[model samples]
Target: MMIKDIKNYLKSVVDCPNWYVGRIDGKKDQCIGVYPARSQPKPVPIAIGGVENTTYNKLGVEILIHWGDAPTDAEEKAQAVYNALYGQNPEIGGKRVIKIDLNTSCPVYAGVDENGIYEFVLGAVIYYER
Candidate 1:
């Protein structure tokens, strides 16, 4: 569900038409893939009566941009994704996203794949209400 939410959000923001969730479809050289990285639920404070409550979930998301033989294009696309998502809070799939913080200052350049596709990786922590 979180991956779908992110994929939908990215679809609205990024220009890429090929967006995949969970895994990258190698058929398209110019595409974006979103997958879950590291994630955990955030525990909330206990009430005065000793009842515990949890309202938020922290999800780590990884976005991979692949551009055929175009390292600059891949990096630029990753940067565009970063600019669109970093520090932004928007409701995605009816979930109230509290914030999004990128793990790196910018997208990391991953080496070209065997198919000669240049790839860039972007990681982010998305905090949203459950």
Candidate 2:
């Protein structure tokens, strides 16, 4: 339930036109976590935690975004994400989110290709009440 709440929160905060719940083929310029092509930006992915903390109802959520052609692009996008969700406790569905903190964010390798395409990952923990 927390994962579902996290995903729903992401769908509300993220500005991307195409949003995927899981990894997408990286063949496109962008995807949730999959790589497909590089010509244009594709869909973005939001990965949810496999296991939840029954004691606290905490869940790990990650958002993958394309870095675009410049380093500023990546930084800007990262800032946008942080600006959108950090420290804001929004009611997701019937659950009240206690907090959503930015855990970690950095550039990640795109599979084995290691191309020059820009990409960064935003990690967070969403805590909610059951």
Candidate 3:
């Protein structure tokens, strides 16, 4: 499925919750093409906390998996997403990422990892904005 499809799928899994989507960088402020496209890719760990076991947490906060060497197919990306949110598959690289949507049902932040496996990947989670 494409990024669009993933958005819908995330809604179902995150209890049909809604979340604000955006691209992020590591240990830095959230960005959305604010700079040039060719600008540095944030030098791995585009996310802040650094993907591992800390990015995923709470009912929200998901990471947008990104890939570079080889873009993952729709099925592969979907499965990886499932594992990240549900924490089912401990695949090679599926860890919590930085900046959850805070608006989605599961509030999974959008961003890639150091390896670039989850390129253009999306995160989800339900947010309880105050």
Candidate 4:
């Protein structure tokens, strides 16, 4: 559900048409892949009995942008995605997103793949209500 939320959000925000979850479509030279990386629960102290309750979840998401033999296109698309996602709190897929922040300052170049497609990767942490 989180993956679907992320993928749908990206599809709505980013201009690119091809958006996939878990794996990239090999047929499409230019596309984006949204994958789950790591996650943790965000617990808060409750007033009653000083108990900790998890009201939100922090999820790590990895976004991969691939363009056919065009590093610039890949990087540009990655930047667009970064701009669309970073430092934003929006409700998507019926989930209340608290925040989204990039793990790195910019998209990291992942070099060319075996299919000769250029790739750029973005790591982000997304906080949302449980």
Candidate 5:
């Protein structure tokens, strides 16, 4: 619904802050055992990995691809930024985690700019806010 809502929803799905920061060179040095698949719709959503472990009904997959896949100072800290921009936990502990897998198609990224800021996209399973 809203970026804030999405943030909180994502956090709820994964125990981590639900944020990612980094850049990618086309699935280069992303992670381990990353697979690729298509979701649906005419665009053919790409399924990188399993959804956030903390999420249910796959409310995450439907999330638009943004906030990640960019350059930032810290990758993990990006989650915190994402949270602030997104939403806060309504009642912490209500949900322990949100899990998403980072498949090949949806590889995470970390900016290799002069500043060397890390970034990432809302990957599938492995591509979570951890």
Candidate 6:
């Protein structure tokens, strides 16, 4: 449910047609990977110090924006994502985005994939509550 919530939130907030979860492939205008960080155990819905289920869930997302050939275009798309999501709380697809704390955004990289598409990549922690 959190995965769907996060994917829907990304799509709604970014207004892009290519939002995805878990994997990125094909020729999408945008791609998102919402997964638990490999460095830590997956987050659980149970409250940190209590047995009861909490309304909040938190996880990291790896975001990639592809703009075909131009680095500037990719940067523009990345900026749009940052503006829409960074540090803002928004309700999306019945879930509430409590906060989006950006971790890092890489510079526009050329030939990011075999398709030679220019891309800007970012990582963030998404906090949400239903």
Q: What is the per-residue lDDT of model 5 for residues 97-124, given as tens digits with 9 covering 90 to 100?
A: 3343333333245344333334443333
Off by over 4 Å in 4: 38-53
**Native-vs-model 3 lDDT?**
0.33
| Best-first order by TM-score | 1, 4, 6, 2, 5, 3
Estimate the overall C-alpha local distance difference test score of candidate 1. 0.84
Q: Give per-model CA RMSD.
A: 2.5, 9.9, 16.1, 2.8, 12.7, 3.4
For model 3, the run of ten residues with the poorest summed lDDT = 29-38
Per-residue lDDT over 59-119 for candidate 4, one digit per residue giving the tens place of the 0 to 100 score: 7789899877877888888899889887788887788989887889999999998889999
lDDT by residue for model 2 (45-112), tens:
33355334333455566666654556566556656656666778888767777887665544333322
TM-score for each prediction? 0.86, 0.62, 0.24, 0.84, 0.26, 0.71
What is the RMSD of candidate 5?
12.7
Who wins the lDDT comparison?
1
Return model 1's CA RMSD, one decimal: 2.5
C-alpha RMSD (angstroms) for model 3? 16.1
Residue 14 lDDT in model 4?
89
Runs of candidate 1 exceeding 4 Å displacement: 38-52
Q: Pairing residues by index, what is the TM-score of model 5?
A: 0.26
Compute the lDDT of residue 65 as modeled in candidate 6: 69
Number of the predicted model whose TM-score against the real structure is largest: 1
Worst 10 residues of 2 by lDDT: 34-43
True-vs-predicted CA distance for residue 110, candidate 4, Å: 0.3
In order of lDDT, best first, we have 1, 4, 6, 2, 3, 5
lDDT of each: 0.84, 0.56, 0.33, 0.82, 0.33, 0.65
The digit string of per-residue lDDT tens for model 6 on 87-107 reads: 688876676778777776433
Could you tell me the lDDT of residue 72 within candidate 2? Answer: 68
